[model samples]
Target: MAQVYLHTMFGNGARAMQEAAGSRASYARMEANAGAADMLTDREADFIAARDSFYMASVSEDGWPYVQHRGGPAGFLRRIGDNRIGFADYRGNRQYLSAANLAADDRVSLFLMDYPNRRRLKLIGHAHGSDDPATIAALMTPGYGAEPERAFLIDVVGFDWNCPQHITPRFTQKEIERLTAPLVDELDRLRARIAELEG
Candidate 1:
C-alpha cells in the first residue's frame, strides 16, 4: 500500500513524510518543497552560462499557452539588476508564438537547461519584443548574429534552480547528426529514383 501523509503548510514536505513514516530506513526519499529557503543558489549563474537553448512559454490574448525554443549566443541572458534578467531574441521561423504572446500578455516563463551539466533554470517574468539597435548588438554572437528587426527584451521576476538528477544531456554534435542523418538518407533515395527515371 502507498503511504499517505497530510499536507502541511509549513516545513519541508519530504521531512513531513519521513516523520510520518517513523524514520524508517526502508523508504528511500529526498526533500521536496513549494518554496525552499535556498531554492535559488550560486549554481544558477553557472547553469545559465552553460545552457545553449531554452523553452520560452507565453500566453496568447485568448488565454492560449504557446511555447517555443529560443537559442543563440552563450550569454543571451544578462543580469539587468538583482532578481531581474534580460534575454535577446534572435531571428526564428516565421511563426512568432512568443512574440504574439508577449504582445497580449507580458507574463512569461523560461526553462533553460544545460544538457552536459544536467542543470536547469526556471524563470518567471514579463517580456517585450524589441528592435532596438543596442539590444540586437548585445545579443549577437560570432556566427549567429541577431537581426536588427528581430530581437526582444525580457524582464525577469522569479528565478529558481532545479535539481539535475533526472536530466540527460544531448551534446551539440549529437543534435546536428540526428537532424541531418534522415535528410541525407532521403536525398540519397531521391537521387537513386531520379537516376532510374533518366535511364
Candidate 2:
C-alpha cells in the first residue's frame, strides 16, 4: 500500500509461485524500493487521457471475477485528484453487472492498454457508482452519442506499468488513417500527374 503495486496484487499463492520460480527475492526488493505507487503523476494522467478503452475487473458476491470492457472517446477516463479517477458509465445493456458487483465489493482492478505503443498500465482501486449530477457531469463527454447513466469513481490504491511482451500492435481506424495519410497524398498526386499528361 505504501509504495508497491504487488502489495495489493500478489497474495500468498502468488508469492509462493514466485518463490518456486526463484524470483521472490527480486520482487521483494522491488516492493521495498518502489516509489509512491498509489498516487497518479502527470505521466499517468497523460497515459489515462490518451486511452479510449480499458478493462475493469470486479468480484461478484458469489466470488466469481468479472472483467468488462469500458470505452469511450479518448480521455473519458480522467484523473480527478491525485489518487482518484472517474468515468461516466455510458448506457449499455440493462444488466448492471459492474454496478452490482461494486455494491458488494468496492475493490476493482483495471487494465489500461496502448496496443499501438505496446504499453500497459495495471491498477488496483476501490470504486463506487454515483448518480450525482455533478459527479456525472465531471466525467461526461459532451456531444458523444452514448447517454451516460451514472459515474464510477475509483480511488487508486496501487498502479504499475506492465511489460509489453506478447502484445500485438494494433491501430484504431483513426490511427490507421493518420499513419497512411502520406501514402494517400502521394497517390492523389500521381493521379493528378497522369491526368495532366493525358490532356
Candidate 3:
C-alpha cells in the first residue's frame, strides 16, 4: 500500500507542489487511509523473491543521494523476518560508497523493476551492513560465484507499487530465449522436412 509511502515522502516541499497542482486534498486522504506498511504481505514477498536486481539509494553524509544497482540470482534477496530482508553484498569496485553511507545513516530506498511486465515496486527501509558469516552465508546463493563482503539487511518501513505507464518493455537474454523456443523447434522440424524431401 502507499499509505506509509505517501506519508513518508509527502514533506513540506512535496505538499506545496501538490497544493500548486491542486491534488493535495486527494493525496492527504490517501495518506491517512487505513493500512499498515511495516509488514510484508504475500504479494510483496513473491515480488521481492522474483527480483534478480534492484536499485538501492542511500544518503551521503553531505545529504547527497547515492544510488547503486545491486544484482544477484533471483530470490537471493529473501525475507529474514516478516518485514526484514537482506542480500549478500558482493565485493565491487571497492569504493565502499554505500557501506560508508550506511554507517552514517541507515535510511535507504529501493526500486525493484519487472521490465517485461512494466511493473515497479518502491521501498523505504532502514538498512545496515553485517559481516557475520552466518548472515552472509544465509543470504548467499548456491552455485553463485560472487565473493560476498557482507550482508546488507533492510527493515522495510513502507512500500508502494508504481503505475506501469511509460515503462518500455524489455527482456533479458534468458527471457528472449525462452520466448523464442517454440520458433526454434519449428525451424528444426522444417529443416528436417526439407532434407527428407531432397533425399
**Number of the predicted model whose lDDT against the real structure is largest:** 3
Alpha carbon lDDT of each predicted model: 0.65, 0.91, 0.92
Clashes of 2: 0
lDDT of 2 by residue, 87-127 (tens): 99999997999999999999999999999999999888999
**Per the 3 Å backbone cut-off, how many clashing residue pairs does candidate 3 have?**
0
- Which lDDT tens digits does candidate 1 get at residues 137-182? 7656556645545556665555656788889876788667887999
Candidate 1 accuracy as TM-score? 0.60
Off by over 4 Å in 1: 1-43, 174-199
Q: How much lDDT does candidate 2 score? A: 0.91
lDDT of 3 by residue, 1-199 (tens): 4788888887999999999999999988888784667468888899999999999999999999999999989998878899999999998899999999999999999999999999999999999999999999999999999999999999999988999999999999999999999999999999999999999
TM-score of each: 0.60, 0.94, 0.95
Better of 1 and 3 by lDDT: 3
